[model samples]
Target: MNRRQFLCTTGAFAGWSGGVACQARAEAYTVDRALVLVDLNGGNDGLNTVIPIGDPLYRALRPTLAVPHDQVLPLDERTGLHPSLGPLLGAWRGQELAIVQGVGHDAGNRSHFRSRQIWDTASDTHEYRDDTWLAHASLPAASFVASCTDAARSIAQHEAAVVRIALHGFDTHENQALRHAALLGQLAQGLMMLRARLIASDDWHRTLVMTNSDFGRSARENAVGGTDHGAAAAHFLMGGNVRGGLWGAAPRLNALDTGDGLPVSLDFRQLHATACAHLGVAPPSSVERFAPLPLLRV
Candidate 1:
């Protein structure tokens, strides 16, 4: 049979009815899950977006910048959304989004550069000397969209996806910010396309984005000005199966004194555990060691 026919026949098992050969090719792969991680680059503040407006201390500390308790989009009594993150509100409203608050590794470094590196490498301060961070496994099989020529190389050494694209620069749009966001959206779409290309299965799972900086960073720093790193930034799980709602405590700005930044409720180790589990790796710390957070359940 031709490739198209082969894909069509196989896609039937994944519940897809299509003449597209790619669909059949996709069906051939038994493992069809994906994980898309994005870095916020600079440390994104969690406190601003997932605000704990109920806490008077929160308002007290950021008297000038605090999101008005009334103005914030209330997810619950304590948690609220920054106005700019309206797009995420839908996910929250649907209960598919799980916002694990207080998720920073304990004793996090406040320095933007160092903290970001630690997060990207997923290494503890102690293990920093051992280079274990560089030993991260490559993105799970067929789980990457090569965005750069160096993408393959980076993944080869560090075991991560560094997606590349062919788009050229030098846009003259009067609305630079809008244009930039548009380009990024397009880039995400392209990456999604690449992801789809890598899949050869009918039962394709959803995609997710993980990063150190929270969504609130772009709004606060780029739009507002300087930033102070906070704990427990917002993460996104985009797929058909996401639970779609707020999960985790709102950022406790008042509790900043407890650490260099707001304390994390969802342990980063737990997130690692969820990632491993999503890759179909079973638990009890046999394959990998990480704390189990509720991220997977949602």
Candidate 2:
């Protein structure tokens, strides 16, 4: 199927009905907070990003690819941040960052397109959805913006309640070290820049920043020194009001699934629900089964 046909068939058209309904209800609700979603398009190697320094199993599993204990910035005795994420240490030290471990759905699908669709629609592995959860909720005109590389620019130009930034190139199937480091560095630098701008404009307190991905990479490295698509990666939530600290326990490297992938400790929908609460709106009816996480202090 062509791209347009595929999108329409999968549920992209499902939003028109909800959008109309939401427009009618929008007059009754008001929210002052803003949410920024940073999507890492490729499956991120969570094991390398958030090093489990104290876990013996991690070092044993990927001796060559593991970030050495000394290289990581310790968040606690057990875990630490990757070296390339040094720019984010300030947020962590100020208690404005929360690391949520093992964020993914059950029965993970490794395909890039399918997994991303599931995340975008917040659907189960067996189900197909066309409309994104965001489209089901209405806001004021020009209150939401979605972009792949222009989120920062768009945020500066438009007064939106929600902004989505999608960053690609996390799929590191070969020579991962160099590619991953560059990507992480860019992410760190961009976030720091955005934070500084927001704080200077006195908008930081009202804004929330979070990161997600299609899935996590395998714990074990391949022959080429890169990880394959896996499941249950780590995610981050940061902002002035975030309840900074670790939200979920790190996955056990030794107790991997049959495919040598980390088991999910936190479902991603919880994060979405939290965003809905922050924006003063109810979550999409489809995700009522999942509760919002206590990640914000507001």
Candidate 3:
């Protein structure tokens, strides 16, 4: 359509309009990105994984549990990885990792169930609600995952990027690392499902950002027991769309400072922003509002 006729056809229809231009720009881009969010249930100690060896404060915080500087898998002078996260580090080396550190909401609640709900709901600290409560009123009943009602219930109210999976076994502590790893696997699978959906939809012009995290709500105990509430956990993102290659500005190992028993560097919302940007959705006004990330590959 010519410019004059286009302008006369209402701004909405005018392909030249500002809003239309942005949307078209995003749509026109051929990046079919999908995401898999692995919400790690326990705050996995960020200082250890994305170590802050440069900071002496970190060394003083957890002398016993601290990952020594030499043992860390170095990303740079500022950060490193936990020995346990070997597989992920491989992804990092291959430029398939984007470690957005210091992720947590403001006035954080240390409660496992509460903090987790906040992460799920994207709500604020003062806004208390029943974890058992579900937003069935907002979801399409057909979309519900009958097998994992509680898991699906938490996020179904929000706009999902075509697919969703409900996870339930993250709270188990008997096999801590095993359970977390299993959860990660499931998250990866979920993203694969979303990827299939995106491809099937033929919206091959998008991008995806798969992400998931755990709350450090473990009740601290012995070597083979429980873990308590702490801070600094890990979230993994894969797929071809991610900037990857270990992107984030946090300290290194042996430099950790568990001041409030959590990493003080990264704010969870910033990671949320990164995710929203990856998902191709506008960032929410506040962390409480569910923001659509722009991390999709189209």
Taking the tens digit of each residue's C-alpha lDDT, what string does model 3 give over 96-191? 556665556665666676777776655667876443111111112222133223222222222223222334555443445455445544444444
Weakest ten-residue segment in model 3 by summed lDDT? 132-141
TM-score of 1: 0.59
Worst 10 residues of 2 by lDDT: 137-146
Candidate no. 2 TM-score: 0.84
Collision pairs in model 2: 10-130, 11-130, 11-131, 12-130
Distance from true location, Cα of 40 in model 3, Å? 1.0
Q: For residues 143-194, could you state the per-residue lDDT of candidate 1 as single tens digits? A: 2233422223332222221111233221211222333334434434444443
Clashing residue pair totals per candidate (backbone < 3 A): 26, 4, 76
Q: Return the top candidate by lDDT.
A: 2
- What C-alpha lDDT does candidate 3 achieve relative to the native structure? 0.45
Query: Which residues of candidate 3, in runs, are more than 4 Å off?
Result: 1-31, 56-59, 68-70, 128-210, 214-227, 232-234, 245-259, 263-266, 283-298
